[model samples]
Target: MPIDDFDLAIAPLKDLGGQRVWSLMISLFGDLARQEGQIIGGPVLSAIMSAMDVRPEAARVALHRLRKDKWIASEKHGRISHHSLTPEGRAQSQAASGRIYATPDDLPEHWLMVVTDDAETGPLEKAGFTTLMPRLYVGDASLPVPKDAATLPGQAVPDWMKRQLEPASLAESYAQLSDALHHVARDLAGADTLTPLQIATLRCLIVHNWRRLALKHPALPRPLIRDDWAGLVAHQRVAALLAAYPRPDLPEIATA
Candidate 1:
């Protein structure tokens, strides 16, 4: 591929942990196959990974690690291989899918908040609740609150609560991603047709960057969301690009 053909709009994802081969593999499968029993054949998996510049040996190692960690399971049919997420892995991925693929129109009207003076707040934060304060966590109504914690129903969102809902830098990050998405869109529009490898590469990068941002912020209601926030625009552009470059056939993505 020529240097000009590739668009690294979001060239450097800052402050993120180095992209691990195993983690990227998990993200790929979660994006592509989580709904379809998370099953993928060896050749197809390899082809997609290769499109993203992953080495075959590195993929093999990552697959082994995922299986050992109980995140994935594999089966063999003669000489060919197939892999699927383990039950535990599917549950984790499904939980995250709600956030990653969520639309503004689908947001709930009410929210649930758990306030306690105990040490259970750590678990709540890990489970996707946004920290309103030291012992306070706010989440959508669907979020599960601890049995002993007091649940508060959202009525009118206060300014203080909205301020605490998102980090100061989050809005800026959304603007940056929106800009990057626009660049990618314009670049893709000029192309006649993208090869399967090119399509795979572009999709993977977009998904990876978007996924990180999506998971970083809690799902706040319109009243709480900042007027200048660019998340909605970024998501809309990403959806359109993904639609235009639908996943290519396995054979077309294969390099060997």
Candidate 2:
């Protein structure tokens, strides 16, 4: 309950908007507790969520929602509560891990186009295609293109198209996250060890923020991605910081 450098380190991410409590908890669980037999005690959850500026009432509401939605299961042990993802939830989290944690170098290198009517765009878009124009969608070439597939000649994206894809707001958000992470690295410098709560809180905030931005668009090819894209830098910072603060097993956190 006492404050330390982590108090300063977590301030920037605290006031950021668009953070849904349930989704943020999902991000936390996905990062550290998605494995079988993993469970987080109420005290650990409170510590991590408090550090992230989540209120107790809101946290309880999120737990209720997760339970009702069958995304998580909670247990009562004497006067304390413990939580873990349901089998369904763990499977969903596992499915997204590769995309969420992939290195920038491992991003897709080729892309293709699919021409579909408005009615058919829903399924393709859900599959990670970007709507470049009406009836035209662009996505990773590795995916099986539909019947109306079109080859991307030279795999080049024009200046106008690049502008359409990478908006100023998106760049700014990534830049902000990248800056915040730099500050965290600065604050935690010379730290030889950190409590499990500290590590979980940092990982949750970083991953939650990054996932919101990274999953906003498909993993487009290098040619399609802008040279000055802030996401590129932010992605590197996320990977590096996550490595530096390796996630602890659930037992360490449950008893912290």
Candidate 3:
């Protein structure tokens, strides 16, 4: 069958390592398959290694690992061994494409919320507090504080707290949290309704961009806006809507 666009997107990753190694493996496989009907033994492997600027032994090890993992199947034809993807290998390639190429629209609605608070509270209370922190609380009191009480310099006066604080670090942390919430909302709410894959991608994006966002908004009080709880409620509503949708089998590629 002709390769699908999604398959092509994940083709370079079949060996399942870092981008460079994956690309090299894909390239070598393509070259060998195209030049000869099959690939076998040291010479072909050595040429692939040279092309990739990796050692021959490294290439041999990678090839052996791919074979052992059942990513490729081989048959001895005379002195040469021909290798091709097994049905499982083809399925794996397709799955990788679904994971890396499918947009949030392809995912289903369901969200995982991670709530953190400075105080120890019941799970239900924590959920409610995260949802209502901005509107229910007054002024700066709604702001997130260090969880460690011992870290408090004194009586916890806001002005004194500001002076003692690292404004840059604070802003960075708040920005990181805001960015994470934005993604969670996007993925949990759905393309039409939230999908797990979308949620996961959003979560991943949050982790990836966290440091930069944090640096940009250091020391800013949580919920810089008094109406921040409204957004959280909106998020909750979206999650509920997604929950109403029928759940699909979580795709294997989505794990980890």
Per-candidate local distance difference test: 0.71, 0.81, 0.36
lDDT of 1: 0.71
Q: Write the per-residue lDDT of candidate 1 for residues 1-256, one digit (tens) a residue.
A: 3434653422433222335778777777676667645467788788667656679999999999999999889999998898888888888888888777666656666777778768655688776677888788777788777787898877777766676576676667777777877877876676667776667666766667678778776666565655445876777776777778786654466542
Question: What TM-score would candidate 3 get against the native?
Answer: 0.28
Which has the better TM-score: candidate 1, or candidate 2? 2
Q: How high is each candidate's TM-score?
A: 0.72, 0.87, 0.28
Taking all chains together, the TM-score of candidate 1 against the true structure is: 0.72
Best by lDDT: 2
> Which has the higher TM-score value, candidate number 1 or candidate number 3?
1
Provide the global lDDT of candidate 3 against the true structure.
0.36
Off by over 4 Å in 1: 1-17, 36-38, 76-79, 112-120, 123-128, 135-137, 142-161, 168-176, 195-198, 230-233, 243-256
| Maximum-TM-score candidate | 2
What C-alpha lDDT does candidate 2 achieve relative to the native structure? 0.81
For each of the candidates, give the backbone clash count: 0, 0, 13
What lDDT tens digits, residue by residue, belong to model 2 across residues 96-162? 8887898777878877777764546677777887778777877777777676565564366787886
